[model samples]
Target: MPTLVLLRHGRSTANTSGVLAGWSPGVDLDDHGRKQASAVAERLRPVPLAAIVTSPLDRCQQTLAPVWADRDLPPVVDERFGECRYGDWTGRKINDLVKEPLWKVVQQHPSAAVFPGPEGEGLAATQARAVAAVREWDARVLESHGKDAVWLACSHGDVIKAILADAYGMHLDLFQRIVVDPCSVSIVRYSETRPFVVRVNDIGGDLTGLLPPPKSAGNKDEVDASDAVVGGGAGTV
Candidate 1:
């Protein structure tokens, strides 16, 4: 078995501005996002991580910076974990997108939703690639680090939601029910029989329990989610 921790990149400029960043470049984290990144890094410091995998987007890289600084572990850039390609809708305002007929399809039946344009990618296709990536990574980690290995995957909201949907054995159309906020953490442990979801959208928690007792011992930084007070933020594809 191996533990996979999915962390959504902190709030980005596009998020604050109410735009869908999609695969657009030059979108970095805001000040509040920087704080959220730092806080998440501190929260996970007590847990032993085998590797850190991140999307190639700037926002994801920026979010991983603080964790790299704290743990000195370089992140492996994986494009499979990148944000959904919104095609012609890239960089468009959410309010405007909501007015489109396809927006309702995206919300109600994501499996049938497809972005417009030559490079448009379907929502089901996105989920397929993302789930494949995570499963492949999970197998690799188990082989290299053995069971109990824990790793972090930094990606966008929709991307993480798709992965969670697969982990829960839910269809792509039901994925919209899952909410992956900026800087939020969700954990999944994959075993031979099934996958166990330990936590979802956990802003803060005593993850020390998830860590091996030997590694977590003597770590006074361990604090329960209720004891940790952290602010919330938002995100988009």
Candidate 2:
């Protein structure tokens, strides 16, 4: 069995600002996010990693930068691991959108919701795409590197949870229960026999004998024009 780890990027500028950062363009990680990724890297330093995969977003790469720097590793950027596309809702303040009727419904019923904009991917589509991406990546790793290689992936919060749900046979409503904080870690075991969850939503440096064991982890949207074309991306380690 190969150990597959999915890590959410560390905190970003938009995360601290309380804004919705869908597929925007330039947002990057904050200081705390960097620290989180650094901590995760330290934790995995001893494990020989077969590959470190990430979303093609600055924040995601930035979060894992410290880890890669320390371990002398490089990550393979994959578009499939990107965050959910919120279309028109990208780059706007969360408070501003929360008041909109459609936004409220989407937040309350994300599984069935859709953003009002062009090029926006629905929750179903987002979930399906993320699941497919992970599966492909997992298959490739196992085939090329053998079954027991340690695989790591850094991705967005939504995509991480969606991937978990699909792999573990959980429902989308349970998505609200899983939280992958910036720089948090989630582990899954992939084998020719089956795929299993090892942990979910674990913050790096939190396992200092003070944190609880990994459990069924418990724990997003849209756009803007004049939006300054704010950028968005994914994170992982």
Best by lDDT: 1
Model 1, span 1-237: residue lDDT tens: 789999999999999999999999899999999999999989888878988999999999999898888676899999999999999999999999999999999999999999999978898999999989999999999899977789999999999999999888899899999988999999988877667676888987667756743446677876432232255322111
The segments of candidate 1 whose C-alpha lies over 4 angstroms from its true place after superposition are 213-237
> Candidate 2 lDDT, tens digit per residue, 1-237?
566788888889999999888778899887887777777878866667778999998889888787778565689888888888888888888889888887755655768877778967887778888878777887888788866667788889888988887767777756766777788888877655456676788764433221222334442133221122246323123
- How many pairs of residues collide in each model? 0, 19
- Residue 81's lDDT in candidate 2: 85
| Cα deviation of 15, candidate 1, in Å | 0.3
lDDT of model 1 at position 236 = 12
Quote model 1's TM-score.
0.89
Q: Which runs of model 2 end up more than 4 angstroms from their true locations?
A: 70-72, 205-237
